[model samples]
Target chain A: MSRINDVGGMEGFGAVPVDNAEQPAFAADWEARVFALNSALLRRGVYNLDEFRDAVERMPPAEYLDASYYERWFAAITTLLDERGVLPRADLDG
Target chain B: MSADHGDGALAARVRRAETLLEERGVVDGAELDAILDRYLATGSPANGARVVARAWTDAGFRDRLLADANAAVTELGFRAGGLQPTLLRAVANTAEVHNVVVCTLCSCYPIALLGPSPSWYKSEAYRSRVVRDPRSVLAEFGLTLPDTVRVEVWDASAETRYLVVPRRPDGTDHLDDDKLAALVTRNGLIGTAAV
Candidate 1:
């Protein structure tokens, strides 16, 4: 429930697992697109970095941990745009 | 306000938002795609390896890199823009100390330098464990440091990013920059391993 993003030195997390296999940066085209879109919008001043980060951090702990890396980005972008009233929910639905 | 929607649904929403931005003239679709292609291409750890290799060979440049990382990297013609420019710090590992970078908050990484952050680096386990038990985390990465070496964890934030300058491996003095760069791995730059 805490909005704090700094989790360094916290306890109760499990053992760390390492995946050393080499892989492409993005798993698919959509990931690349999302990556570009997020940076593009950020550069264009659609939203500041902290606000976008806040949107990501505001996620419920369970959801944050369960979601994939880009999933979190998508969630943040959606929430930020919604909060800004730039992209309405109806547009997202339809 | 989160959905369990699969990647398909998430991709659809991402596309919709992308189209919305284009339609509003905030960003051009073609330009964004082209930029994205270039961005992804530039994300390999090789870029970081090159920086580390240069640092290992040139002490003067290493000092400059440690003092002013962004400027030093720009001197080598590597710069990142778009998504607010933040301060980047380069922490060098010596015989006595080792450093590891993590974003306990949310994978705040130097994507511009090391390319995309690895999936494991973003996992909650890594964020949660690296800070608490860095030695074990390093061991998991196949890097077993001696007890004499101190482990320092750098937590990345919204305003600052960190890059680890791994110690040059033994018997590498004869190798050229390209060869040394070839030896540098992404994990090495992340302090999970040594170059």
Candidate 2:
């Protein structure tokens, strides 16, 4: 079940890009805050790092591939909170 | 390619989550923002570059860094505590062998040393393929090694982080610390590119 996140040595992954020098530390303000939010939540013991990573692992492969980096974090964290019944759909649907 | 300003829906959802966390008294908005801002300011690849430059110039420091990377970083003012993971390991690339870093499960990296990881590092392509065929992956980064040289791929995890210390390039023997640090790119520190 957790094997989904262990992506090493899998085949069919294409060419690696050459634009590593171009990216900023983060793309947008919200993106940085989202990362910070994960850190904050981890520090506050809302969930452990392993559980957070497990949430990400359980995301659909297609959605995981298409979303931006922090977008995935947002999705995964929201999924985790909702699953735990800590945050309802109404809270995030706004 | 067109720019990505980030997803609006995701941002809105994150905002709502922030509000909820505040309402639940899990974290205060202002306090969290301040901590993130501090990390954003001090955590960068430049910190790693400086560490490499010092190692290149000072033999004693190099010994200390290679022996205990986590503590060595503190000597350069990058203190680790209070949620900062302590198991950072520094690897060196010599003429006979090279090192590359990847996180197969997630993009677990030494953020304080390398700044936030580049998006590609977190991409499924790089994460999955790098460890399998590091030479080819390095080639894509415009680095090709001789057949005689060996490649070692380090998989970073939540418990342990890795930093690459590349062999200093020739013709820089006369350079000062700042000048040498300038030549150490973020990719060099990640072992995808030579300094």
Candidate 3:
């Protein structure tokens, strides 16, 4: 099945924003933390890059579209951890 | 449904996940901090620009970069992928051809070289339209190519990434390495604009 992340040729999105000033590497502290966490997890063998990508791709279409870039990475990291039994879904809620 | 960086719930969830991983011995906060520091120190557009500058000055390096990007980049102390070995392909922009890179499925870019991708690069409008109507998309970025210049859009995958080797601008014969590298921009390396 074609996933929402597979948005190659499909259109309807508005104009791409072009800003001359370079954007900071991370928008916020949380975003940076998410990036670091994802990298650390991947390096530690908690999950491979493809597996994390699959988790991101498996997100619901609306959810995937709604989430920001690092938010999606956070979602995939949580999903992989939950699936791997490293962190149960309930634990995150609690 | 859009989750912004200010979303408290999302931030809380990320923190919770980090704690859980630490408790489970999967990863620690110190290690994660170290990784972030490493990226902050080395990841930048300057790295990619330096590679482009060297390629422009040294024809041998240019040939090696086009032939085997991964190994060639290593010679300059730059690695393509993070945490995994990703094949890097250098697509050169010539007088007759313009090359652009995109990951339709996800934002699979050479982050180590180009720093973080620009927000527009990961936008739905770019990922979906660039492959279909590159000229129109390039026009949106204010890069209007001639009709005779064939555009090639490269779709990056999980195991592979692409970097655009922009053509050297004229009248830069006397510039040193640093000066030439300074002339290259992030957009130029991404093929969204000329250097």
Candidate 4:
């Protein structure tokens, strides 16, 4: 089954946005935090890189599309933690 | 739901996850800060540019880079892999060929060299079209290649990341490594534009 993330060669998504303006490494503080959290979790062996990628790919299509790049990373980190029993699933709900 | 609405909810969830992890003694705030700092310090487009500059000046280094990019990059004290080990392949752009790198599945770029990928690189339009119709996609990026110049689009779907060594522009023979490196941009290293 091809996931939404496997979006190579399927068209209809218009022109790529090419704003040459200076783009920051992280758009927001939350984004940096999310990136750091993901890195830390992976380094700690909480979940492997493949598992984290699979969690991102397993997200509901709508949620995955609606979330920003770092938001997707944030979602994957939460999902992995819940699945690994590091944090209860209810913790993500609230 | 739009990304704007999702951002608020996701931010709260991230904060909750961080707090939970900290409380459980799984991850520390300082450790996370250090990870971010390490990337911030080492990850830059300049690193990739320096590699390209070395290739432009030293033919031996260029041959080594094209033959084994992972080992070649290590000579400059740069880590090609982050978190986990990944293979790095250097594809040189010659007079006959032009190369571009893309991650069709996800944004799997060489972050240690080129910093984080630009927003357009991760967009659906680029990932889906670049692989199938590179000429048109390169045109969108304002890079119009000649018909004779064959375009090669490398899909970084797996662990191997690709770095494009753009051809050195003419009249740069007298320039030092720093000056030559300054001419190389992240887009040039990605083969989206000429240096």
> How far off is residue B166 in model 1, in Å?
1.4
Between prediction 2 and prediction 3, which has the larger DockQ?
Answer: 3
lDDT of 2 by residue, B1-195 (tens): 113443675566677788987898877888778877887786688889999999999989898899999899889898533265558888989999999999988888888888878878887789889988898899999899998989999998878888899999988999999999999999999999987
When sorted by DockQ, best at the front, the candidate numbers are 3, 4, 2, 1
Candidate achieving higher DockQ, 1 or 2: 2
lDDT of 4 by residue, B26-141 (tens): 99999999988987888889999999999999999999999999999988888898777899999999999999999999899999999988998988889999998999988988
Tens digit of per-residue lDDT, candidate 1, span B42-157: 76688888899999999899999999998999877887433668898999999999999998888778887888888788776788889888998888888899999999999887
Q: Which portions of model 1 show Cα errors greater than 4 Å?
A: B1-3, B20-26, B80-82
Clash count per candidate:
1, 0, 0, 0
lDDT of 1 by residue, A1-94 (tens): 5554456666766767578888788886777887787877787788988888888888887777677777778878878877788777777778
True contacts kept of each: 0.67, 0.67, 0.78, 0.77
To one decimal, what is the Cα RMSD in angstroms of model 2 from the true structure?
2.7
Best by TM-score: 4
Clashing pairs in 4: none
Query: On residues A9-53, what C-alpha lDDT tens digit does candidate 4 reach at each position?
Result: 997888888866669888887899988988888888999899999
Model 3's chain B TM-score? 0.93
Q: Candidate 3 has which clashing residue pairs, if any?
A: none
- TM-scores, one per candidate: 0.90, 0.90, 0.95, 0.96
lDDT of 1: 0.82
Best by DockQ: 3
